[model samples]
Target: MAGMLNIGVSGLNAAQAQLNTTSHNITNAGTVGYHRQTVGQAARPPLFTGAGFFGQGTDVTSVTRSYNQFLENQVLQADNRRAQYGAYSAQIGQINNLLADSTTGLSPALANFFAGVQEVASNPTSVAARQSLISNGQALASRFQSLNTRLEEVRQGVEGGIVQTVESINTYAKAIAEMNQRIVVAQAGGAGAPANDLLDQRDQLLAELNKLVQITVVDETDSGKANGAVSVFIGSGQPLVLRGTVSQFQVIPSAADPQRGAISLTAPGGNTIEIAESLLSGGELGGLLEFRLVSLDAAQNELGLIALGITETFNAQHKLGVDLEGVLGKDFFKPIAPTVVPAVAGVSTSITDVSEVRAKDYRVLVSGGSVRLFAGDEELASLALAPAPAWPATLTGGGIAVSLPGAASIPADGLLIQPTRNAARNIAVGISDPREIAAGGPVSVTSPLTNQGTGKVANIDIRDIAGMDGSGDGVPDFSAFALGFDGTGPALTVPAGFTIERLKMDAATGEWVTDGSYPSGGSSTTYTPSADSSGVQFRVTGPGGYTFDFRFSGTPESGDAFSFGPSVAGVADNRNAVALGALQTTKVLGADASGRPTATFQSLYAQTVTTVGNKTREVQVNEAAQESLLDQATSARDSVSGVNLDEEAANLVRYQLAYQASARVMTVAQRLFDELISIGR
Candidate 1:
């Protein structure tokens, strides 16, 4: 009876303990950073007999919880990557919103301004139209300034985030180190199993750590004990954190020039060091860094590229024409400064005064009714156009020389230089029908070259426009033969007294055509027969040559004096705009009123507007796409690793049952012993 009672009691006790464990799990289901636990049971030693052994009641071996190291590691890594992209996408999206947004967006204001310009281009002499353009121009500049301020705010936020993350990492590391100390002591005290709670604490810390950076973990047992020491690291053998009695770690910041920031780690001296929680690979901090610092920064740079392109191209074109203000060619758009610093030695320190050599300093001279392009020196010329090249060129020669217009001789200090006749235009060359170049219009060389003697020289150099035989004059009349040449063949011939230079070509779309007569054919015109042939009549080439085909450029209304010649037009002219409808006086706003368009109110509403609205739309579309991609990636990551209530509830029930069973077993065993004693009496 006693033996039977004992066996039944043991069974009952085990069942009750299980119930308790499940209850505990349930109670803590909503706890943050909690893991489920269960009691692991095993049979007691069997009684040895001559024939066989009798089974003994079960006993708890060690309280074990469900865990998969490999799976958890996967979760950490994915989370890290997700965080990075999320951060980058979020910050960049904000910038996109500001720059290309629709409602209360800067883009609308910019478009309005451009529309005003179109109006001005159409009616250059109208004071009302000109004033409206001036108003719009001020508004556009204001948008830029506002956007810049907002970007600065974002940057400050990132910096603050970094500091906060660092502090959190330090706290986690200290806690881990303390846990290690306790764990080691428990093992040494002859504890049968590891300190489970402490282990749970450590594991939790490790998971948190992975949010910042990827890490590796190691488990080592005491010489004779099942419970062991834990060590964490970044890779194969790089110590991040170590635990002897407690955990100890270090925080190291990034040292690279581009990413000069700090990161935290555990156990600087340990064989297996681990990245801290704030610096780990799986959390929001990582995402923020990626989105705000890395990705957004890159996007901003691209925006600068587009802005700079428009500014430089327009300025170049504006330089070619004389504005009504009596100023030959004031820079229409200011040049964009390089957002990224160059890799040159002593660049930051040596170049202290940027204003002295800013783009505004370089002046263009349209003297003698001909274009004379010049640069101060070879170095300045290279610097001025550095933004022109997509990739950096290797410096084979120390510096290259440039050929400039109005050059009696090269400046003593090498201050005035021009693109060598052999130098190519850096722009991508376009080739199509000959009608692309307008009759008697200016043409631009498509390719640019810093160094000379490349095979890609423009067929018609602006400097040589005077010598083109447009009239088939035998003397090669230097003045009447203003012609334009694409680096490719089928150059356009400019007739004398014609202000229209080259025919306009689309940059994004490869389409070309001339603006005036000879839409597809031309009559033969003779200047002077070559001394060898008297009856020679110069017939212009057709289909493939001087035949005119109409192509649209920036539209101008009647009374607009703007005209491009075949010899001076190039891909850069695509950015030009003119006003046609409204007229007003020009008014320059003061610095304080730069960003406030409504302030210092000026009216020019009825002015004609011809804007480059098409281009702005492209920017808006790109920003939207990038934002959507980032959102999707972030959601997927959360699903994989984020905490779930249902799963936690299930674990809670399981652990509660185990705890109840353990207690029940103890109580029933006592009752069984009492029953045996009473029966024996």
Candidate 2:
């Protein structure tokens, strides 16, 4: 009877515990990160019987939380991927809109400015038209400046975003560390009951942390405290947390760029180490860094290329013309001195030629006293990095200049050098006066009417020569001389383009000027015409060796004369203006290191727009797909671990019935004991 009563009491206790667990599950069904609790039962030691062993009573064993490690890990990974793409897609969309918009973008400004150039070419003497050209040029410069400002604003915003993300990650890391401490204390004894709810809370914190920065989690149960816990790491095994001890991560303003924030880790000895930007990936911070480093940097550099190409090429052409002031045309566009910024981690770079600059950030890897350059994975150049000791090192041909300082300066992972990164913002108009516009070529050439021949001279240009000077008076020199090709007198066998035929000279100053007659006994010089000259050349030695050419097309008499004249001051000369307008079709934007032409300005700008648009489109599609995957992963995890209220409700009813049956059993045992007692009495 006593044994019967004890068995009934154990059954009652088990039923009561089951009811309590079911009630707890149903009440916390909607709780975030909650896992359902389950109770396990085992039969106590069975009493020995003659026939077979009979169970003494049912005893409750461990209560476990419904969880799956693989399913939970799947959820975490999916969340990280989705967050990274979503973040990147959100930020890159701004640049896409900026470059593609016709109203405020670079296309309209380029078109209107070129149109202004053509207008001036049509009416070279019109002050009103020149003024319009200046206005259009100013508008274009303003547009470049404005676009640069907007991009900087975007970068600053990204910097702020980075700081915020690091702070959140730090908060999560600390909280997780605290939870680890609590869990270790709760489960001190081996085989002690697990703090399931506390584990859920810690896991929830980890899920949130991974969204800001992707991390590698190590189960610390065997390592940290012999209790169930995890350690977290990020970016190539940089430890973030070690059980109850956490390493602090922080964002500090970059020394190279004050507007940017650098990520760092704080070691236990109060030492802060800088984290390389390349090591980070797979979360919101990763996405922002990608935008700042790659997308934003490339766009700014591409914009700079247009500004630079126009600056160098247009100014080169502009200098070939004469201004309305009867003087040489100065630079119409101010030069943006190539930025040679040194990295905080010990590397420096500068652009050697604006025409050859590409929209890419190059990496400078230094190792074994030699350096290698890479645009991503493609190796652009590699050379010995030993100190030049004489000249500035021209790395990777003459396109980029690099410097490696002392022995310990180079980082093991190298550095990134972005030369044209800030070009557009600093560009502005160099010449503001409309009268300074060069609209006329510096020299003129023609044929004399006395020459009864089809021979012709065309397109004479004054090429640059050191120490060359014009007359002190503001008026251009208009000396007239003739290319007298005496075909009968001397049957001179000479190079057709440059010949030592009978020479002539005529100048106000008779010192080495062309006068159509050689000195009495002086040695006559040769003539070297330009390449397009058909069969004749007229060369002069003075003024750094000026040369002109006549296309000796048909038969010439004994003395066929071609005439030369200096340009008139402030006249309607549109040769230079027309050349400037023709630059619209010139392949001046893209030039490789060896001076090979690639793309024009129009095509390069279009490529930039297309690249940004494609990246945005790709991210949008991938984000949508990742979101769907994340949702599916969450559902799968929830099915096994998540609590269901309906099931718990049915469990409550079943446990109550078991409890009633156990109470009846106890009552029957008491009645049997009472009957036995009565019979004994």
Candidate 3:
């Protein structure tokens, strides 16, 4: 009876443990990250008798939670990726809408500005038209500034997000470290038994941290046994949490670009390292970094490029015309210069060729007596400085000219060069008065009435007005000159400061053949007129960089003559305005490999809009796909580790029945004991 009672007591304890485990599971079924617990049991040692050993009742051994490491890791990875794509899509969508909107975009402003130019060209003397043009110019500049402001706001928002995300990551790391301590202590006190609840809490914290930034987890072992501690690493093995010690994360300005924010990690040993943006991938932080690097920067730079193109090209052409007062036209728009960071004393930068400018930032590195200029990671130009620093030395590359003064010393940390980054923000109209608009060409041409030939000067195109000012005066140095054609050929009586080149068309090939060149001081070129000689073309050049192309068509008699001179008080002439209006369709924005313009202003802006729209669409699709993947992965993980209410309820009934059976056995044992005692009495 004693042996039976002991066996019945052992069975009762085992059944009680199973019921407790089942109750615990049922109670915590709604808890996040909670795994169902199970009771482990083993039969006690059997008593050895003469015959076969009698079996002893069961003993409760251990309780463990159902968990799978592989499935959990898969869930984490999928969640991180989904978060990254979602963040990226949210940020880029704003830029897409901003650029693609017809009313708010640069395209409409550009078209309206050019339409105003056309108005001015049509009515050169109308003050209303000129004032409207000025208003349109101002509006265009304001549009550019406003667009840049919006982009800057987005950038600031990204910076704020980065700061918040880093703070959350650090907070999670500290909490995880504390949880590690609790789990280790609890497991140790439980005599090698796993602390299931504390382990779940730590895993929950890890999953939360992974949403902010992707991380890798490693189980910490003591003497080859898992001590319920883990080490967490992020951004290519940078330790974030090590057992009981937690590292910290900080947001700092980037070394390459101070305006941008970067992530830094501070180890427990007092070492801090800035993580490269490219190394950090997945999660919200990665998405922010990537969006800033690829989308935000590119959009701003491309907008600035368009602004620069408008300013440079328009100003160049405007300066070649005469205003209402017959004075030379000043700049139509203020020029934008390259921006250099860490302002070096006696160093200046300028844009020399707008066509060659690319939407990129540059770096100037000076080390070992050599100065190297880099556009991104590629070296553009390298020069060795002289033992004595050269004064007024110019380094030209990527359409920008960097000038260094004699006293200019190379900065040890190098300089950052941004050619067009600020152009959109700073662009403005240079002229305010409507009458200051240059609408008349500087030079005019006419045919002498005494000419007997049907030959007449059909067109005179200004090649370079700056080249025409040979007398060091601000005015173009054009003089009265006549080109008379005799029956044998055409002869030019050139002025003292003028040089001319003559060309004739070959009938067979239909190509112009250079006849001869006449130098200054009245030189003559002989060419016999032929029936197949289409016409005569003359390229006349004057001092002070002024040049023009003159084409003469039709047969010229012996005394046919044409003259050229500067236009005086030519307010009614709209030749320059016509030329300026042509800029709308001109391919003057981007250049090909051979340095030919490939895109008009409107076309380039359209391309920018298209690129942003495509990127936004791509990110949205990726986000949706990642969402699907995350759902699948979560389901897979939950299938193994998640609690099922129905299953837990069924377990409760089964464990309860076992407990009753054990109670009945114990009751029978007690009754038998009573019988024995009664017999003994």
Give the number of the best model, judged by lDDT: 3
Best model number under TM-score: 3
Tens-digit lDDT track of model 2 for 249-279: 8898664444468899997668898888888
Candidate 1: misplaced stretches above 4 Å? Answer: 1-23, 33-35, 46-58, 74-89, 104-106, 221-227, 235-238, 244-282, 333-681
| Residue-level lDDT tens digits of model 3 in 1-681 | 777777878877887888888888878878988887888998889989999899888888889888888888888988898899888898999899999998999988999999999998999889899999999999999999999999999988999999999999999999999999999999899997999899999999999989888899999999999998999998889899999898888998777677778898888889988899998889999999899989999999999999999999999888888888777788999888888886888889988889888888878887667677777776767678767555667778777888776423656657888987889998999999998899888888778888886776755767688655456555655566776676654455455666677666666444445664433223455434554246567677776657776676676778677777877764587878888898999888677677667788898889999999999989899888888988898788878877788887888788778878878888898998898899999
The whole-model C-alpha lDDT of candidate 2 against the native structure comes to: 0.75
On residues 107-180, what C-alpha lDDT tens digit does candidate 1 reach at each position? 46646865776765555445566566556655655554555556667766775666676566556656666777
TM-score of 3: 0.92
lDDT of 2 at 10: 92
For candidate 2, the 10 contiguous residues with the lowest summed lDDT are: 519-528
Off by over 4 Å in 2: 189-191, 222-226, 253-259, 342-352, 361-388, 391-418, 459-558, 592-595
TM-score of 1: 0.52
> lDDT of each structure?
0.41, 0.75, 0.82
Q: Of models 1 and 2, which has the larger TM-score?
A: 2
lDDT, candidate 2, at 70: 93
* Candidates, ranked, lDDT: 3, 2, 1
Q: lDDT for model 1, please.
A: 0.41
Of the two candidates 1 and 3, the one with more favorable lDDT, higher being better, is 3
